[model samples]
Target chain A: MIHLQNVEKVYQTKTIETVALNNINLEVGKSEFVSVMGPSGCGKSTMLNIMGLLDLPSDGKVMIDGQTFEAYSDKALAQFRNQTLGFIFQSYHLINDLSVIDNVELPLLYRNVNRKERKRLASEALEKVGLGNRMKHFPTQLSGGQKQRVAIARAIVGKPKIILADEPTGNLDSVMGNEVMDILLKLNEIDDTTIVMVTHDETMARKTHRLVRLFDGTQVN
Target chain B: MIRHLFLIIWNQKRRNFGLILEIFFSFLVLFAVLTFIIDKYNYYRQPLGFEYQNVWSIYQDTKGAPKEEVFATQEQIRNALKSFPEIIDFTFTNSNIPYGSSRSITSLKKGDKEIDADIFTVDEHFASTLGMSLSEGRWFNESDRAAGYKPVIINGVFKEEAFGDEPAAGQMVEDYNDNPLKIIGVVDQYKYRGEFVKPFAGFFQRVDTTFAVRSLLLHVRSNADAKFEERLNKRLDQIASNWSFEINYLDEMRKSTLRETKIPMLIFIIISAFLVFNVALGLFGVLWYNINKRKQEIGIRRAMGASKSGIGRQFVGEVLVISTLSLALGTFFAVQFPLLKVFSVQAGVYFLSIVVSAILIYLIAFTCSLYPSVQAAKLQPAVALHDE
Candidate 1:
């Protein structure tokens, strides 16, 4: 579960302060799929970053489950973020030097999982994403869609409570994008994984169970 | 954690190995040079059979004294020296003192065997002044002097070879001129050069020589201080005449050390410190570089509920692992250079050198990793998520 109450975000250089998000309120319940859509400079990615605990809102109370993160130590926050949220990005972000299995095992490695068990979990996660046979292949060897699938497998390996997709299909063709979306839809429906997806596509927004739009920093429900 | 650090080094062997080898060689060479010096120093001091400490040598410039000289006879000179309260004992000997630079060596022959012995002419009190202990036969008494007796004192080496301990006192050996002389005393072997240890050698002292000896050895009970030189100079001025000669202490007369080695060793130590310092710097730089290169991966890891400490540990652990591997490889090569010289090298020399170098290596690697590791452990998930 996630909640944001009247969040405000500002980006400042020496001369000016630019508001990224203004008076934004949002919530996603357990096992719910919510798509947030906005035009460029409308704060959808900024909102997603704030919800993912990757950045702080200038003025906000972000509650994950039921705790405000203002007081969480940096280490505690990092641990909380890594364990609670799964992230997918348009770029896939696979470590080029690592094999598919090593990439998937990255999160568990951070969790200090035993190497053999991490291998087992990572392979199973790769299997779930239909890339078990390609565990030893590097990101350079995989197709764009397969790379994205590996990223997805990496996401599920740690079994985080929430899956956050930020422009997950921005770099894919419609056919590949739809296939990736089908994977996410299955994950949402079959596994009941809480999903918060950010996109600029209105069609994609409509497909999710709920949609929140942002324009000029304000949310439109 | 250590294994991972090693893995990190193993991963980037090409990029890092050469510099590591350079450092290793530098330290190894430095250590080897020092060991050679120290080992030779030990060897130099090895043959000084009797302790030279609390002992001093006085150089008497006994040029042609006038017939009306104040102390002309040997008796008068000897009595004056005996009266000097600061003197513990004194004797006159030829310039071929042990560890003396002015060497006069000649081969001695007996039957078919020719043995090289350093010949020395000394006063009746020379053996007592040198504190030489006899290992087999008694040293030359006043009765065995070449002036009144045909006896010579052969060292333990000549005794071992020529007599096999069968009373070398009556054996005859020929000098370079083939002048046959009877050995009256067989004394122990001792050092001939500097403090460095050396092989077995012989010293034959002919005590009956009436020739004018140039060097006077004095064993004073005081340390090697500046004051002893003043006293010795004053005494020599009383006894010596117009021919002035340079007086040197035993250590300076040896000239066993070099100024060049000081320069190199100093420079090497400085370089060693910088080597370790630069290694640390390189380690930190590489970690930051890798972290910057992997922002997206780090972001993904953070998203997967990976702790910041875990991610930081990943990077730091990787760097530390690399450092250890570099040192191990470096040490392996380092030890090999000395180990190869085993037949030519002394055991104590190589062993001490390797141990000292290895310790420095471990310390360098360990210290180099501390700061970089701390920085790696501080990776912010938020910053990493937005990284390019």
Candidate 2:
């Protein structure tokens, strides 16, 4: 479901140039769960950002679902992201000012969903993540594990074909981390959703269908 | 979308309360200042109904002289004014002159419909001297002295207040003493107090022959200057040696009256401008701080599919919602001025002030939010996500 060919990403400043990702070629088929592992400063997040279309590659082609998006405008790209991709960040990234339900309904807000339909779908997503009872609470009121669940609900509320998780369980305890991993496994196995996760934990990386390692901006395996 | 925005603001009410209060106070100040300005402008645009250019008011202080002496001195001054070629016309009157501090107010009654009105006593030459035109009937003359009732001329506003749509000429109204007063003519308008004051219900009564006239109005030629004034004072001294004359140019009196009204308004405007500027600065700082605090939320929205313009719209729209709430409260209080009759201004002026104030507040909010929101929109989603 995701394709990258010779993708190279460079970070430049007035006096320095740093290559973030170098000559990377990777592919994940439909409904496949892939995990990327790397040490700090090894460009793991940079590769995920490029694949999630959050950052552009310095050189090479990025195609999603068999279509290249080099000519898409910012608005078109945003719309494509809305319709085709979901994101989960390490910090959960829940708006503290909004309630759990409102946080879950955020992605569908950019779509054409009406208020009632958005509420219904957000409620369903929360229920699936065991957060139905906490929908009225704010992100500040929830624990780290519950906040990540809310983020997952938000990510899956739009029913995107692909979910890009950047350290989804990084802030949680091992038990909570296992719970979140189980939710992702169920989503992949039951809904046939494609998943690409960036993690540092070997245990979590081994749970995925495949693992790709990066060292010093280049894929090692 | 508006509901969602309002929900967000509402959920953050504690954080936004101070901002709401600031906007509310700004709106109230703007409303008050705008109302005062618009009311004054409305009054200024009206016709004062009588000409003041090239005219002078002479206050003849007799210093408690005998009544006959006062009358004789005013008659001498009138005759002396007629002799000068620079003098177009002159009339003897009481102390109730236009823009003067003195006033004579009494109630007039017509068939149980009574209204309070200012009273002015002048001679037959008063209208000609002051360049006043009658809308109906004629100015007072010696023929009116032989009539059964005292002749009086009511202005159009007094006419409407007393008689509504009916004709006022030849109508008889009674004075406070129940003495019959005949309305011989109707002047369209006579705003005697000054340009910044509303016209009141008032009428002119013919001066009695036995009454002492302490003031004289002179219609002079356009070329009359300080030299002519010096010659007239000399002539006055020659005619009535004991009487002291205080000559005041009507145009100069008008300028002084306008200054009296405008100085306070100008000061108020300066103060209001400072207040609005400070509010604008506060709003800009708050929006900037809010954007800095919410970078991660902005990044999340961007990652969730909001366009850059969408983020900009959200920030700007949030400020507009806050302004809307504040103005709503401000308008609630502003309408009380007209409803409670707090000021003598018209209701329409208060409503117009509310509209203008709302527009100004929205403009301030929009301007203050624009730059900060644009900077927020320019944030790179990947970088913003990593922001603590």
Best by TM-score: 2
Question: Against the true structure, what is model 2's DockQ?
Answer: 0.79
Q: How many residue pairs clash in each candidate?
A: 18, 0
Q: How does model 2 score by TM-score?
A: 0.98
Candidate 1 residues B300-352, lDDT tens each?
A: 66666656666666665564455455556655765675668754557677667
lDDT of 1: 0.71
Candidate 2 chain A: minimum summed lDDT over ten consecutive residues — where?
A65-74
What lDDT does candidate 1 reach at residue B201? 44
Residue-by-residue lDDT tens digits, candidate 2, A73-150: 878888888888999989999999999999999999999799999999999999999999999999999999999999
Cα deviation at B109, candidate 1, in Å, is: 14
**In order, what lDDT does every prediction score?**
0.71, 0.92
